[model samples]
Target: MTTEQSWWRRNRWPVLALAVLLPGTVILTTSSEWFDYQNGLYSHAVTVPDGQSAVYGGAEFRVDDTVLVRGGTEGGDELELDPDMDLIVAVLEVTPGKDLVDSCNLTISATSPAHPEKRTWNANVDLPRKFPPTGDSQTTCSDSQGEPYRLVVAATVPSGAAETSSWVQIEKIGLTPNYLELELSPSAVSSASTSSDISSSSTSAVRRDDLRQKSNATASRLTRTGSTIRSITNPIG
Candidate 1:
């Protein structure tokens, strides 16, 4: 046989093994993702109406309020934002069940025509703007202290973003992928005129104490219209 034929003959077994193993490795690596996609965990959401409560990850959750802050505070250091940006805050009432609340997470996500894919932001704890004192409220699920607690979550959005629709999603822990989606009612609040509108004592409950501790370098002053809020990243595109 020629040199080419001899080489092919010598390597035939190894080539056959590689061909089989390559496809097998790919399938094995992608099986979990494929299963999640097929089960609708990646694309499905059960929309929950506003002011309504639902059980998720062994915890009861309800979006108590939503606010869209526009202006800045009167005195002290103020955070300036891009003209196209605005602040959005959501208050969630959480009552943990047998499961530890720490295992679950809450997030605010929005969908707009400009970006069909969902844009998600965490409950930011390091933003400069201070909200009102959230008497007895917990900023995180883990700090619930086995009692019903309020979760104050805030995120900055593009100006007039998600006017059509936005939601508060509770991340899945040990539960099914069918997660809860609570609709947000974004009402305007100005810290300049009636700063207490977004205060923790009001219906729109939020706290700036813990966040102040985390981001002392930023603005401690709460503005009337808005603040230079945190930018949103990590789109679930």
Candidate 2:
């Protein structure tokens, strides 16, 4: 080959490499990302119901409780939340305390989007009159969709109890949400490979030859994300 031809041959790959790399670097750096992580919600002032057979050791009320329900399920057929991933986290919280004085059972759970069922977790008051009521509880759950949750803390007390009393005041509490994340598959969102999962040199050059199209596809994904959020807020049949 002539000297000019030899020079071009030696520099050709490097020149093409720069061409491929510069734009890719720009695209990747500007590319938006969505990652999954954990989040929590806290409860408002919580109160048990009144007039059951198991009041308190003496008083007919419960102490204010601050509950932190993190993302999931401790057991059983978990509530199918994520129709896509079907992911769920069991949640439970309680400050240490002694057993109740009267033997009464309770159920707590969120009653609405703004209200969670508190009756899902409960215990008997106490027996033979113990001092300072105490009980611990937990549950498997998904976060609310950002709203108020009226926690129904219903106590089921045995009727005609000789000594122990039932019935306490009920209270509505706080609610929270978990970070719901989503990623589309090839079929769900067909486009150029955004990134090679592998960094090996072997497949590095296999990026889509159509740069303009890849860019358009990337931006369209954000729209898809918005659509997903809307669906989650109001799902279709």
Candidate 3:
């Protein structure tokens, strides 16, 4: 037999198997990449208006109350806030459809009445030292007590956040690509019109300071020549 013919006869099955499997492996990898790309492109926010409820992740959630608590030094766990930062608390009434409660993350999106720009603040997971307590309520969705319960979430925001219209957003864990935003209505805990008005200058200063501090601590530290050598935190959201 010829040398080429002899080699082909000995390895024909293995060569054919590789030819078939290589394309399938490429397709499998590309299919997952396509799915992730579509999810990133199509993810959107569904706004649940005030006094309304939205069902997500087998749970019905309604924004019961949204309070902008100002001038207090309430802390949670090991986290302490700047005196210029106020607390924006949202109380949600969540009813789980099944026995298992869904886990969710909370965020506060506030738009300044004066500036018309949106700012987002993530909920602090720490239990506050002294907060406007909701009796027997759970701080997270996973800590449900087998029935409808209030879930409290708080974010430390700039001092004059009371002047901004805010919404509480709930992103269900394991069920992604979209999130629910609950509109905050006018609360009985009156807005601090005076504090917000007078503290606007100080609030701007505080925001600049916060940005400077976070840039120094969380953002990548650069060399003297201004090239980043190591990143301290993930910049992607």
- Winning candidate number (lDDT): 3
| Residue pairs whose backbone atoms clash in candidate 3 | none
**Candidate 3 local lDDT, 1-237, one digit each (tens):** 655567878899999999999999999979998889766642567776656777766677776544444453322211244566666655666777653554667888776666568787878543235433344556678635558876766777776664657788877655556677777754312333334432232222123323222223322121011222221121112
What ranking emerges by lDDT with the best candidate at the front?
3, 1, 2
Give the Cα lDDT of each candidate: 0.55, 0.23, 0.55
- Regions of candidate 1 where Cα sits further than 4 Å from its true position: 1-33, 36-43, 71-82, 129-135, 186-237
RMSD of each: 11.6, 28.9, 15.8
Ranking by TM-score: 1, 3, 2
TM-score of 2: 0.17
* TM-score of candidate 3 to 2 decimals: 0.56
Stretches of candidate 2 exceeding 4 Å from the true structure = 1-57, 72-101, 114-237
lDDT of 3: 0.55
| lDDT, candidate 1, at 74 | 21
Tens digits of per-residue lDDT, candidate 1, 44-99, equal 57676655667665667776556555433221113343345555666666777666
Q: Give residue 119's lDDT in candidate 1 (0 to 100).
A: 86
